[model samples]
Target: MDAVQGLETGDTFILHATFKPVPLFAVMKAKGFTYESEQLDKKHWKVTFVKRGLGQ
Candidate 1:
């Protein structure tokens, strides 16, 4: 969460995890971010979060 606090509008952060982080989607959305999730393989998933502009 600390990492997210540093994001500026239009900044993107990519997260890699062992499992699909479904819960985090809602959290990011509430913080004005849009995300895309991709499963790389059986054991890895990648989620990209982009901070949106005001009113976006």
Candidate 2:
């Protein structure tokens, strides 16, 4: 979660993982980030998150 800690307003992060990161998604969503996710293959997923304004 280092990415989350370093995020600033209007920053975006993209991550690729071997499995769907449901727990990570939950934490980021709860922290007021907006995101989209897509499955790229049987064993890969991509998730993008944007950090908006504070308390968003």
Candidate 3:
């Protein structure tokens, strides 16, 4: 979570959490980030979200 605080201007990060999906998106949104997610390898879901704090 601490890494979330130091997000660069236009950096993107991949985050993993428990076996839930909706809540993860909710949390990322609440933290001022836009995100997209998909299931990875059919085993688990991988979420790819972007932090739009700044730009290049």
Candidate 4:
């Protein structure tokens, strides 16, 4: 799973630590977000899921 972007523990993120809600980082990985695993650390990931629609 991916990590949260601009993660500041608070203020910048919603900080969802609940079983009902999946971790933001996990959500990112599930969305197919990738990175240079060879160079990147396990703590640096911020994948987001944008809903696709006909129009904004």
Best by TM-score: 1
lDDT of each residue in 1-56, candidate 2, tens digit only? 77688888889999999999988877888877888999999999999999879666
Deviation of model 2 at 19, angstroms: 1.1
Kindly report which residue stretches of model 4 are placed more than 4 angstroms away from their true locations once superposed: 1-22, 35-56
Per-candidate TM-score against the hidden true structure: 0.95, 0.80, 0.68, 0.22
Winner on lDDT (3 vs 4)? 3
User: What is the model-wide C-alpha lDDT for candidate 4?
Assistant: 0.33
Off-target runs (Cα >4 Å) in candidate 2 are none
| Model 3 regions more than 4 Å off | 17-20, 54-56
Model with the higher TM-score, candidate 1 or 2: 1
Which consecutive 10 residues in model 4 have the weakest lDDT in total?
A: 9-18
For candidate 4, write residues 1-56 as lDDT tens digits. Answer: 22444333221222222232334445544544322212133444332333322332
Compose the digit string of candidate 3's lDDT tens values, residues 1-56: 78778886467888665444786677877777888777665557677778876431
* Best lDDT among the predictions, by candidate number: 1
**Measured by TM-score, how close is model 3 to the native structure?**
0.68
> With candidate 3 superimposed using the best TM-score fit, by how many Å does residue 28's alpha carbon deviate from the native?
1.3
Q: Once model 2 is optimally superposed onto the true structure by TM-score, how far is the C-alpha of residue 39 displaced, in angstroms?
A: 0.8
Candidate 2 — what's its lDDT? 0.88
Sliding window of 10 residues with minimal summed lDDT for model 2:
1-10
Clashing pairs in 4: 3-45
